[model samples]
Target: MSIEIESEDVIRLILQFLKENQLEHTASVLEDETLVTLNTVESRDTFTKDIAQGRWDTVLKQVSHLKIPPRKLMDLYEQVIIELVEMKEHSAARTLLRQTEPMFLLKQHHPERYLRLEHLLSRSLFDPKDAYASGMTRDKRRQIIAQALGSEVAVAPPSRLMTLLEQCAQWQHQQGILSSDADFDVFQTTATVESKEDADALANEIYCTIKFPGKNAYAECSLFSPNGQYFVTGSVDGFIEVWNHSNGKLRKDLNYQAEDNLMAMDESVISLGFNSTSELLVSGSTDGKIAIWKTQSGFCQRRFSPAHSQGVTSVCFNRQGTEVLSGSYDKTVKIHGVRSGKSLKKFTGHASFVNTVLYVKDDTCVLSGGSDGTIKMWDVAEEACLYTINPAMNSSAALAVQSILSVPLITDQVLVCNKSNRLALMTMDGKVTKTFSHGKEKGADFISAAASPHGELIYAIAEDSAVYCFSVASGSLLGETKISDSELVGISSHPLSNIVACNDDQGHVYCISSK
Candidate 1:
């Protein structure tokens, strides 16, 4: 058993004694002389630093003070035990697993992991590393774990007080208290300023809008290029168009197929995705046809229809961009070679239409959500459904997952949006860690959702024509903006900016930017 003592507590106690002895000035002097900070280490940066340095003890010392969930707490203990095992201190590791309160609970909750640890105790030195290694280093693994745990720890944004003061000063100046136009420091007591910029960092109004109307031109899906250079939308009219992300200008010149802007496919485009470089885009169609287009030239690169009895609902490229993963209305997920134009693997299990699909867990697994109100994780090589998450079992009944967005930089998590009134951040193993609600009580169905470039925020467009922005770390609703008086749907976040793209049923796409 171990205990933590805050060193600052002793410093504070001395200061308190001084103040009680009626030596306020001396107490202030002593505070400055010692240069003891109250508790800045509770900040997310410090906690993450401790984790990165393999100081799991320091992190665990702060766990009770912070609001880390139980599962995350177990992760820290697991890290400690794994490290001890790696150091070849099997006795110490076994002691932790058997004697520690947290590990005792972990064994009861995660028997398989406990069993695996027991097996590791008997395996060779190199054997235990397999559970955590895959061309990844110790530092990188710690970094990933620290990042995942950092969100659960409460930390004020760096310089938050100063930023809020500046914003308040701006608001006061805009209200005519500070009248001078000359630039000056916001902290200055006597300076008067009139800056024409707003302090709100979230988009409140539409910045740029695009209107397109033709035969079956309703946009079914949209995606922003990973480079933040282009925003592309797939339409029911069988046409796909690329637009300048900043200006919303349609590039008709890129299409080499027809002078009249010939369609990308003969059937309705249902889903769209861009490769890591944004150079190539894949679109799935209602006729089960999949096509790849070169983004820069806007020319069709490859087209094929195979292995699906119905329309393709979603398509995404693996990290290598060499193969495509797709889900379809036929209630199946399939992988196809980008160059070979042949079906590579098929994962069949969903009892209803598959709504979304993506390769997760370093592309070793395929994760898909279906209209059957279930999310399934499949092993790519074995072609077996490893785990299934049912919405009803998770306390949200009658909800079908409409879409899934991968949380940026957080490898093991994804944002699952449902048709009912909730969206959740879930683990690849089917654990819902955080759930955000929409249209509460009366219930509003989310049409499409997207995460901010860094996955710090979530944006979901509901059938009510309003877009809701949420804080991913805190699971709080940040802001809500009505995009159209009509029906607004489909969301795609810019890869590099504070901009997000969404479209209405009338084929009118709107780009919203920071206010």
Candidate 2:
């Protein structure tokens, strides 16, 4: 049965117990702190006194006036009848048994017991000791009634706090979200609390600007190292530069040429990614080549030339950094081994250029988005297409997907942006949970979008040279800021901080941080 225990009732019970125990000083202090006053109820007191004094008529009248529960009234009637018989007041007990509803309820629910009580009325003078033979004392019976009344009137049981905690744990477990090692004590720690100062600092305005040189050789792509210590940018001039992200100082010119032999640079670097340890860097080029570089030496360790029939557009390392997945304009996605320099898998079926590709479903499957306006899931082990999603197939306007990014903190959803000036949060199975649009008037065609580290926000760069922020959960537009006067070509979020770096077509990079 559901029970609700009110705070006032609990305080009153404590005060009543304290007063009964003669702890006057402590009771007064508690009453002062809780602002509770002990007010006596004359009618309730009279009803109790009448029961103790064997005044059946008065007890019945008070119970009827108070509108007590039928069951409780029946219990009180049973107790009073037994008491009346024990006191040899048989006539009074018989009169009450005939007049009350409790007699009818007892007859209906407990006919044998009702018949035994009825037999008591027939006796001229029964032994008083016989009625008291049940071994239950009057004080114990009164205590039982009081306990039942307390439970019926309370808002919740005494163990409500523990019950709520258990429910929470069960819910988390059913959702397959709770860690096996987590316990109730985790809630009491400061680790669960978010730092408002750190949040404000991360949300602050653009604090640093990392400028790239060369007017025509703008950066095509930018990525922050997984450790967040370095930022790397791939330029249209075929040079990849790594910078100390915090200070904007050049740490290594990864594409610098030596005197004896020139570093391989057949075309502009379009995509770049760092492994989990930040020890290996991978870059895809327009010449259809994928190169793996040793980060410490800035030297190429493995190269997969003609990785695709057309230019490689996107590339990323899997969770272990042992495998690389890349998408190409040739309408195919390929996975390559980092050490073996061998193609592990190739997924085809995109009607148009594959714009982006990544490992999903615990690196067991690949998700790729194409310019053909379709996203496909491929089973890596089977080398077969599992599902294909066309986001704009129902619309009259053709929409080419520009970018697909994994939503941080959410495992099943990804952020998708298309040329239709629309952005959608979609599930791995191709279901659109929420769609965001600039409306037909704005004509804001998105170039790219990045998710915050916490996955609470998404930042999209549109053709208007403005960056728009949105809430990931509700798909609400949070705000917008103009990052450049010209079109922005690429945007990257810091892996470990609330820092966003965007590169413009004019070879300028702006670092934005939260305040």
Candidate 3:
């Protein structure tokens, strides 16, 4: 009643179906009008097969002139390479490998896949089936294959110089020490950095030094209002200090502790945020709790625990200020309704502690970065993870990431920080378009970055007690200023040209003009 066709008959049927479906018209266009006809039929076949399998090398070898759409190529490669690798077709894979070096290099960027590819390449190079002459026994062939697959690539670790530099950086940061000279332009300066010092003297002549209380190390700070009327500072001392930016005046200081029953010295405020209208201030603390306060009256409005079992590292209010997003050491990002102080949805995807969370484009989506060295884009409205970007994996040289700050230069792209303090420009879909660094000063870990709404320039703070102005178009440091007695903490840009506001770790805020 049923018939099973042979492989040859199946191929014939496939060809017939393709022809009847008018797929031949598409295939013929490649041969008739396209440059693909320049290559032999065998080469074309191999190339098409490779393209179908994501063997970019084969297709590129037979036809490199044709502009291969990047998205299509990636999709094809993801589909094919994964299938063939799972099938253990090492020889066939090697054929594709020999044609494409960039594709191989890209795969090598992925640590896990790199190891597997190395094993596959090693096996293909010395498999016993192809190693010895004819008449080899099954056991002998199996042994050879095992030997081939077992071989691993030999690579040397980083040298002493690299390790020493890394050690120096960590020691400097932990001790709250800043380097004297900037290796790159647009360097951030500290209170110790005088306009007369080295590069600081060479770059800017007239700059202002923002002096802080220097009483306690400020953990973080944020703009008090969109109009830049005032700024708020939070510290490990469990206090939220507000300062009037119009003139140096202490406006208010708000502090609270869990009821008398709970007392802990480790309850430091870690992050701060403001609503869209800047009428409310939200502070996250080391106690894994969030406190919202009325900015005008300095009254504590609500207290939220939100089920976070670890310290909240970062907090941000959505565009409308109706909801708030918070990232914590518990490896989860939780969204909370502002008015009700109710937990909305908890995004649990990061394998490590999340360092920062940001609302993107009118709160249509949110971007979160973590110690796991990944940036995840979440659709808040849909409650779905749109995509993830691992710039650390693609980078050839970068330290393990310490923090991530997203600066939306435009509505289309989101700029995020990689381990090297480099800005990785990513599309909304999570594809990294480029990696850019400003002020090239080595050891200049970005404490904060703010892009102007017009997308012309960006203002950033370096670990040092300085501020840097960057040209977003050229990815170059435009101008810099040295601020004495202030370790740069946060930065925010005016909607227009380079007018910027910066906050220091010492509870000080200053305004600067780039003109």
Candidate 4:
């Protein structure tokens, strides 16, 4: 097999390589032939020449034209003025001080630096080295300006050796030969241990606590938008509330009605899931109805009444969000088209209520976990069970799988929660890789489980109103957070942050953060 490389991409790579290696002539020739002038090269050259030759006026003019950040530009201005002071060009430095925006900004934000520069202008016969306390040489200041401009304009800096090493590491990572968790920070060389530690620490804090509106009914399920800005909760009173998760503001309230009266019991939303892009939300209700809503408008765009014979326990959207999968207490899983609002396919294998459903293997298969102590993988196109997995039985009590989550950043592995206090990380083939148990001391019974955005940690809410954290790599108990006094019902993790949200049976929602 041969790889097809785009001509533009190849040209970009070669030009970048030549420029980094200082082969200016070769890079110029390639640029001319390809008619592709790099976005940063021309501006960088002009800035470099102006700074090196002490062309203060020209440098200021170019700085105004470039899209340099305010802070960086201020630093550049300070360096240039210091250079002028060292050279005893007081008149030139004064002109820059009055004319440049950066100098004025520095005066407003960093008055100390500005006052020092002003004091240097009063010196008549001072040593050049003593003009600025920093003692940064003229050549060093020029280099700093060059690097800042290159970075601001998206130009690759002069570090050919480091660049080559990074390329090798990237290739190794792509080939699965380099473990991402390796000791050496090949990909993130500039990241410090403190930053990583801070990130890991964010997994332990409760940042936001949101209380639902209903006095008697509590949230049964909750889901975060794929972008993590918003979250929706389904309540026992058949009301779905959308919230701005960052600030705990109620965005919309979607109420279900039964002939003008508020619907309860079978109409209660038991499970909710967001589509891949977060544009739509699919909800499964106890009344065997599946509804799709426009996330922005909170309007039910499509509804499938009597989608199942009994309560719909779990609902999920396919990768495209064009289809929805739902598991029901009716003992079956059904797939429905979002546009047509018609049942497209149904799989029947579980001996008990199907609690959770998800798309697997590029959405070609469906994975469902039932109270019958088994998981069944069904072929979407064939409409048949492809395989069944019975996890290792640890007790004589009937095994009722409560929830299933695809392990974040992991392939063919899922986190499964059962009626008992234990959670299992198992492969699609049903092999248990690790088991996390909530010791009897806590008296915590698993209600649901969620994996962190990066799959490094697994979070579970138990009967004791506490959230338990487990390390996915070792299945060790990392920590636990007591979120409420009422029983916790549902939990979800932000897609891109170390934030987790859990709702309790008392209409309270707690947003836990690692920070």
- CA shift at 208, candidate 4, in angstroms? 2.5
Please give the lDDT score at residue 329 for candidate 1: 97
| Candidate 1 residue 149 C-alpha distance from true site, Å | 70
TM-scores of the candidates in the order shown: 0.59, 0.59, 0.52, 0.60
Candidate 1 residues 364-472, lDDT tens each?
A: 9988998888999999999899988885434546577888878776678888887866788888777888888754655357877887755778889887888998888
- Worst lDDT 10-window in candidate 4: 255-264
Mark the regions of model 1 whose C-alpha exceeds 4 Å error after superposition.
1-201, 252-263, 392-396
Give the distance in Å from residue 230's predicted Cα in candidate 2 to where it truly belongs.
1.5
lDDT of each prediction vs. the true structure? Answer: 0.76, 0.74, 0.58, 0.76
Q: What overall lDDT, based on C-alpha atoms, would model 4 receive against the true structure?
A: 0.76
Per-prediction count of colliding residue pairs?
0, 15, 10, 5
Residues 1-515, candidate 3, lDDT per residue (tens digit)? Answer: 11234554334334334444678776455444533321122333344444444444554353443334443333334333433554677666565544554456546565554455556556534443433348864344334432322221111232433454467555443322333442422233221333223211112232333445568655455554543434566666677766544344454322222221211124777788788677888888887898887765566777787447899988878777778789999999999887888999888888888888888766777888888878788888788888877767355643334445445335567766645556656776777766556546576766666665345555666776676666666777666677535567666554322345676666555656432
Candidate 1 lands at a TM-score of 0.59
- The C-alpha stretches of model 2 lying farther than 4 A from their native spots are 1-193, 200-204, 252-264, 440-442
List of clashing residue pairs for candidate 3: 184-440, 184-441, 185-439, 188-466, 189-465, 189-466, 190-465, 190-466, 191-484, 191-485
Residue 197, model 4: lDDT of 39
Candidate 3 ranges beyond 4 A from true positions: 1-214, 217-219, 252-266, 381-384, 393-409, 433-435, 439-441, 484-487, 494-511
The TM-score obtained by model 4 is 0.60
